[model samples]
Target: MIELVLPARRKDLGGFEVGRVLPAVLKRAVGPFVFFDHMGPADLPAGIPRTVDVRPHPHIGLATVTYLLDGEIVHRDSVGSEQPIRPGEVNWMTAGRGITHSERFEKARAQGDHVDGLQAWVALPEADEEAEPGFVHVDAAQLPAFGEPGVHGRLIAGSALGLTTPVPVASPLFYLHLELADGARFALPAEHADRAVFVARGEVEVDGQRVAAGHMAVLATGRATDLVAHGAVTVMALGGEPLGPRFLEWNFVSSRRERIEQAKADWRAGRMKLPDLDHDEFIPLPGDPPPPPNPMS
Candidate 1:
């Protein structure tokens, strides 16, 4: 069995740490999944109050998938969506052409509240890259859930196990949230051209190789393998066939480099629209002026 282990790099945001796994030096992407971030398994530590806030930002030619293991977030988009997403639920926002949005920890959260989640960016097919933007939220109950003796799981998106999720996706793909009891094992489907398993917590072995928490194991293409949990464990299985080459710049994604540059210009010129409520605030463009000449040459 061929396996490529991707170590996560921690990025600090306010009071939390997000482990970035995809777009690594060795691997740029897994199928259409171009960006993957595992946020916070951190505690708030009493007497300190911090609210997760991601100001309004723009995106193009991709869909954002937000899945939470704990805590809640309110999502607002230019399409007039103001939805509160909770654990086990899904918030899928497609920036087909262009869209701006913001995510903030639910205002009702009390001090010392805990938060943790996973966020990913899936590039859209070239044909639908300029389709109208949209947003949808699916509750945990609306998704298919199944269990056998020692394994339980929910279809977070795409298709798996002869079942499909309600989350709208433009291309072929799969994302599953699974929990396994000690000694339990589950087999991978060969249908998806690409596949990987992320050990969210606890310990697991994929095709006989040990994978620790916070690490991802990319499986060999079209190979059938088994993942066995050494103890109670949580895993995220995600992948699909290739979406072809995509140009990713800042928060924009497109098949053409010019589209990304156009998006950047639009954002910097204050021409990009934003959510009705969060229209007043946004992250500014990062300046890239030429570096000053070296002084000690």
Candidate 2:
């Protein structure tokens, strides 16, 4: 059953920062998901410019999903795929063996554009870690929408309301983008009893407990759960089958220790290609070394 796991808002850092996260995986080894980041629903004043300049970075053993609630992003990958992802659209990138990419604004927000969205990383099984890299872009109209008046649900990934996301993935998982008007209440499936809710906009009450914006509400594992929107609200729910043993090193994710080690070496030796970008300010630099091996291993 779905159980509330994480209940925390994205902590802000400085410039261009909305929320930064290294989220906890509540069940099993990272669960069926790994990384989740709640970005902006931040507003930009007219005539002020802003841009998302995530430099080229490498990822392995996972697929990345970029969904926008407002604004647009131009995604470019090492494989030469470039696409503009607008509101209600998704950019799903699968980095089987390994892939590098960058996400930046299509145009300066000051130029009358705005930015708001979430970036998620879903892990792949051990066997698919080294598969070829690929990507799929799904428009807003293609995703399934359901729920009663005053409350709406968008199935960004996995299946809901008899509809499934068009992006190919490795496991059984669900990513829901939902919004509810004030005074609206909705029920989640009993299977999602342990799910976590990240409140991006406004406040909500789960099982009678109130949670405001910038905070997360983790539901205790049990039967079906209920939530009421105290105001206009937006939340993202991630649920899936539990994952097995895995390790994260830098941006590389793998189930095998040796594979992660090799990925580190490959990156250090410059064997992997970086995503192309017009500016160098956003490029990702090499980070601190990985942690020591597990003593029990």
Scored by lDDT, the top model is 1
Scanning candidate 2 in windows of ten residues, the lowest lDDT window is 277-286
Model 1: per-residue Cα lDDT over 1-297, one tens digit each: 546999789998766689999878787778889989998886654454323467788999999999989877789999999998898999999999999998876443445557778999999999999999999999999999989889999999999889999899999999999999999999977779888888889989998999999999999986787989999999999999789988887899999999999999998887889899876567666674433333321
Per-model lDDT: 0.86, 0.71
My TM-score estimates for the predictions, one after another, are 0.93, 0.84
**lDDT agreement of model 1 with the native:** 0.86
Best by TM-score: 1
Candidate 1, TM-score vs. the true structure?
0.93
Instruction: Give stretches of model 1 more than 4 Å off.
Output: 45-52, 107-109, 288-297
Weakest 10 consecutive residues, lDDT, candidate 1?
288-297
- Which portions of model 2 miss their true places by more than 4 Å? 1-14, 25-30, 43-52, 109-112, 192-194, 276-285, 288-297
For candidate 2, give the lDDT of residue 288: 50
Q: Give the TM-score of candidate 2.
A: 0.84
